[model samples]
Target: MIMPRGSDQLLLPVNPFFIALTLLLAFAFMLLPFGRHPALPDLLAVVLVFWTVHQPRRVGVGLGFCFGLLLDVHQGALLGQHALAYSLLAYAAISAHRRLLWFGVVEQALQIAPLFFAAHLVSLLVGLAAGGMFPGWWMFLAPVIEALAWPLVTIALLAPQRRAPDPDENRPL
Candidate 1:
């Protein structure tokens, strides 16, 4: 199997527990007292999308839906608003996963920007349809910030898997 020029070395199999832990941590971050600022990034969305792309079989639309529901309950927003947005986001990420992996991290971030925007747009539209007031143009900033955080999140999340499995001195993988 000839590796692509832009691709990194093979990653270790992702641990399910780590995936869950990261998702929960992101959700907890979301629950913090961020004061409902429209411009605030959705860390959960970014992590969810990351896992969905990198481990689609393990973390798919169902997890996204469940977490989104949890967020809705916590935030007191329209019941299915986040759920719908996250489901669509996960689906999109899964669909793009293969093609996305061929790019460098920065290019991957550029490609993912639209998915974040679409998720936010879905949430915004759902809110508007539910008689919620528009959150102003600043709302768009959330997706941009989320996109910007993609590389950092990718590095942090993939760090554990990047280590050599055996770490033999002469066996450079």
Candidate 2:
């Protein structure tokens, strides 16, 4: 629904408390034990996509870079590796927002998953160029995991935003 005068959209504001809580959650996600798996998916990436596409006014490239840097620190990977990927993801999401919205969940997953794959590839190339060691085939699990969760998470988390505006608010301007 369109917000009334002086009322803001549903996007959450970026405040100190929000930043701190976000950092805490990011850290926890990176460190939480999950039976020797890499969480089978990038929860952090999913989060970035959600905010970037739906509430871009609140979350944009800078925040993606910030979160990616935090993830880099937590994962002990090359700094700026994930940051680049994350910011790129945000850009892609914002650019493709129109096409993405019109597609069904299944169709959207097929499309977005490739972008996720490309992001992973870009990160891998950067790491290699920087002389960072490879983590081997198991690392490829990321895209597959990304593919599986991309649609489910988006549909579950952001579908609310697609709902029609409350009809009673209609009025001639």
What is the per-residue lDDT of model 2 for residues 15-97, given as tens digits with 9 covering 90 to 100?
Answer: 54543455456457856666435325677776677567666677788888988898788777889998999999888988887
Candidate 2 stretches greater than 4 Å from native:
1-27, 33-39, 159-173
For 1-173, candidate 1 gives per-residue lDDT tens digits of 76775757788998999999999999999999969789999999999999999998999999999999999999999999999999999999999999998888899999999999999999999999999999999999999999999999999999999999998877655
TM match of model 2 to true structure = 0.72
Judging by TM-score against the true structure, name the best candidate: 1
